[model samples]
Target chain A: MPTKTVAGTTVEVNDEGFFTDPSQWTEEMAPELAEAEGIDTLTDPHWTVIRFMRQEFEEKGTGPTVRALGKTSGVTVKELYQLFPKGPAKIAARVAGIPKPRGCI
Target chain B: MTHRIVILGAGTGGTLAANRLRREYSTDEATITVVDQDDVHVYQPGLLFVPFALARPDDIVRPRQDQLHDHIEYIQSPIEAVEPDADRVHLTDGTVLDFDVLVVATGAALLPEETEGLTGPGWGEKVHTFYTLEGATALRDSLAAFDGGRLVINVVDMPIKCPVAPLEFAFLADWFFTDRKMRDSVDITYVTPLDAAFTKPVAAKRLGGMLAERGIDLVTEFNTGEVDGEGGRLVSYDEREVPFDVAVVIPLHGGQPYVGRSPGLGDALDFVPTDPHTLQSQSRPNVFALGDATNVPASKAGSVTHFEGDVLVENVSRFIAGEELDASYDGHANCFIETGFGKAMLIDFNYDTEPLPGHFPSKVGMPLLKESRANHLGKLMFQWFYWHALLPGRDIPGIGPDMPTTGKRSPESESP
Candidate 1:
């Protein structure tokens, strides 16, 4: 039950720093989380995917698959990789304030 | 003087290399000796199916002496040290064998202690791995008790033997649960340190899609710093955690301990630094390494060992004859990926080409880069081929060390 101070707000995190609970997520908290994943700033494209993923999770109880996101979010698999290098779905779901998505690898 | 070619380890690489070398030289011309810690020779790939009950533990392992040629002398003793400079290997029982040529095929070993808390409390209970005969056998018992909940398979690091085995385990787990009618209650997740589902992009995309279709979860780029087995959590350095009810892990792999005992003979990880193409040890002309024992960028698979053994045997012959060594190994390797439900996919490639779609080995042979029951049968048939054809060092017609491009489609030619 470790806590990390993200964007001047302390949040419960595991040993690695991912938020323990997504319900406690706030819009202002993304900048801190994104920075830790090695992104300098969240741009329009990043927000487009992030917001789209969050909305999809809220409505469907699950986030979009990478293939689904690429087709619907106007981002190609290559472009999504550029936006989120290591793993887009997992990182975007985290930045968008959702629990880790299934099949994100 | 009878030339001595001492080979360390009597597993896939060592066993086959010993047999192949025996074929090249007569008993009067050269003497061969194979040394191992024990008589056990486990078909490592078969361990992948043991937990799923697809394979019996007793069926996978055979005596090392049974697989080797009678002409080859076998030594059962622990390796204390290897003196590369003096051209001798020290055994724990105080026997030192000198060699004119040496093949260091003692392959990579699992290092569970490298990751924090992996071997601690609940290690044999909740946390299990199918990488060894004992682990796979133990997992079979542990899995029977698992009614449901999160079953996580984590690859602690890369460069493991039969790299696709973990994914196959996940795919087979999906099949196992569905067959048991508990598929709904069970949640299977694959956590890897890599970004993609696999190493190569083309294959990763295909495998990733299969994972999505099967409802198996994938957690990527998770550099696990610790395994909280008691708490049932895999905590990564990035602070991301994947909770688990039953855990199957692929621990970090490293070369055998004797590699560390010999200076300038191996890399920091104890993997011998070889001319990747030649399979010759970078340190000395008389010394050579192949299979998982070498830092060869090639897949640390038995198929790679099979193909490498083709070139390695020839190189050993040339070395003994005082001729310029040939760099014949192309890093050529092929594998059948079990995707479950009586279906599998095959991939064939070398250092240059990624896995391409079409027929393999021949124009009308099994399909590549796609799943079919034929590949599954081919995967099953490989066990027979391994013991009978591969380990006996008999070269199959139309197959060699270098990769063939006749039957595969070039990536650019496809419609995107």
Candidate 2:
């Protein structure tokens, strides 16, 4: 296993062909990895909220709540649902490349 | 023995395959027969740029049969059934064409009616889709006549033709309105079901920034529940409302109608379950499909089709030769996206790769996933290449359907 650092998180890559550690994850990595997973198009508006969440986590050192992220990002809860079908916590976790946040449940 | 090759739908894939195969094989060795309901071959991608008046309607479209080889018989009729086991195609006109090999290129069709109230009261009034030639022309007129209000360019769902088209329309709308000095008057919002203006991350980040720069409103994750024409509102199932004075929507797309008529031909959307690499139909050995008709988890773009065309032509020939099928479609698809204001963005990827920031084909070629003046010129030049080289079954010297690893920046591997 090769251990590396991304966004200041200790990332591990297993021989099972995984590249980086999941803990090193951030919302910024979601769109990039998702496309590698076969997402064809990644347009602009998706970045607006993702970037907002990335900045929030960086400032507070904790994931922002769906309500808080939505408010700051100018995205509504309903709209956020459509944006992240798996829910905000899951999206943030995927982007953050970490486990789902505790309060997300 | 002249082997019979039956093709369904005379669209890009079918027509191109016919021409390519004819050039590769002698007429005496194999006979090609193409079946379709109409003879009109609409250059679908041109539909996106049409509303901007960049493409003349007549130039982008041609008779379906006109592009094929003269030796290939073109039957203008709808397909009623496809017997994959028998390698046969039954037309709506009660004619059944049997073949030693069957190629299903019956591409996708737009079904705006799939969305509730989308086609009802707002049919052509205030709600318009530029996915069709008729819709594009009408929207051009509507846009030209209007002083401006709330103009929304929306995508009803994912997997629509030319994924970046709606955004292009918004960018161009900005240019269009600014040219008229009505840019500030008309609020241009791009409404999409996905989280961002785009589906990928890096590009989405850059594009979102572009939208902000251009003052185009990015309305994300809006799954349209209903188009309330009288109310002039697009309501999501969750009760979010997007009010628009003029809406340009890219509607839900479905597979060819003939797929619905034939058993085991397609899924609910009429897209065939295809081997992601070989472009062979999962149902039968003799049947192969590509482009928008296959549910191969690839972009439904012409570039994908062009690349798939190369793989498909080879696979079809291999099937005829009874050789072991080479499952080798690297899922290479590249597209030139018009970003408006004399520029465009180009992206290249395959099944496992996300479009990375690098030079394409080589460091000398167009920039990948980056907007550049040269890329925009390439986009414009493609129209000439499309009519003269691509359709005529002539291969470009430098370009191949497979994505080139050389001259591209790979995060995974270090330089040798």
Candidate 3:
């Protein structure tokens, strides 16, 4: 495990830089995390997706897949790609401060 | 008064659980009943070898009831819905089965129709799947007729039964075409929604390397949104397209339809929300689930169901006896990866660990994560074991419910 500073707060993360303790995340860290992944600004749409991801993780104990997020997160699949870019499921999960979606290897 | 234990679905999990329960409780103690829509049990794993003409459809088919203990009752009826509140299961034929405890083992169902244009123009012709018996049989004919072109194998989504089967199909296809003397003319590609060849890091790297070594192109993170079989194209949600002459698609899989009808019993995908360790349904204490039917984050493979059988039987007994349920199941899952040319690889791991290298069970046992002829022989021998020992709930010698860590060499233990 490794710790990193984001928004003046230290948080634990895994080898892939995903948050180990989601409780350490705050709304203030969202912009910095998003920027670290190449997103410069946090729009309302981004918050909507991020909030939905956190809620889903809290309920299901895992983050939603791209398919599930697209279907239930009030966001279209195309929009998710534009919002998160490259890999919506993985990238958004990191920024949302939830564990990676385990689709069962 | 005898306790009534009703098990839904007579597939691998239900059949073995029923058998193991029978041995645990005598006929005077409990009456075990297993139900499924039909008696046909098509040794699901063997379906993987069908497209390569290695297995005949007829050879794998068997009556599901034949696998159960004679003392257990087997019913043939479609499940209507589970009234968990009433402690009963409703059958489509207007029959209600009451039980002291219920096991929801109805496995995953293939939903190819869910994808747009998948079953449209060239479905059974140019585009086929080997996940089902009919699909595999159809694919066998299609592969035989295929001379040369791009043959793409696409996995529509994840959490599928035997997640490694598609990779196995790709490896076998390479060997199949080469054996037919048309390897040069055929270009093979594997497309998956995952960012890697597999979910786990160690195994994914090895499998990806094998795909590259075999000259099979690997396309990752391509979430297939539609299958335009008529146009011979697979379109991803990201607006990327992978064209193919023959497409073998592993369609999205979900739990049995009846799971959806039964409220408070399943997740959005209809898979029972089960406690991963205890194998008990999160919905109700008396209702339990295993196999591909449960949303347990473990690989949906038969070996998982087999391992889960031991813990499930114990917990069911404990629940019936008004004792504490055993939280012993560690999500142990293993698979024999068929890596072409009479050689295969074995991977064993549990919830806490990913598949690692070294031998299994013990250091002297078959090699793990590395291809070997012995592992391939073990793979072939498992078929016999599945029917004779596994389905009957006989404890396999040296193999136990929990994953053994003795022989496995963790990355930290390896010499730099």
Q: Tell me the whole-model lDDT of each prediction, alpha carbons only.
A: 0.86, 0.76, 0.92
Query: Which candidate tops DockQ?
Result: 3
Candidate 3 residue-wise lDDT, B228-337, digit = tens? 98889999877899999999999989899999999899877788999998999999999999999999979999999999998899999999999999999998998999
Q: Tens digit of lDDT per residue, candidate 1, span B271-353? A: 78788788999878889998899978789999899999977988899988999888868888898999999999999989878
> Could you give the C-alpha RMSD of every candidate to the true structure, in order shown?
12.7, 10.3, 2.1
What candidate 1 gets wrong by more than 4 Å, as runs, is A1-105
Query: Model 3 compared with the native: what TM-score?
Result: 0.94
Q: In model 2, which runs have C-alpha deviations exceeding 4 angstroms?
A: A1-105, B410-416
At residue B286, what lDDT does model 3 achieve?
Answer: 97
Docking class of 3: medium
Tell me the lDDT of model 3 at B307: 95
* Model 1 collision count: 3
DockQ of each: 0.02, 0.03, 0.53
TM-score of each: 0.81, 0.80, 0.94
The residue pairs in collision within model 1 are A16-B238, A16-B239, A17-B239
lDDT of 2 by residue, A1-105 (tens): 666544455567444324334435655556665454343444565666666655665654455555455446777655666666545544644554543332210
True contacts kept of 1: 0.00
List where candidate 3 sits over 4 angstroms from the true fold. Answer: A1-17, A28-45, A76-79
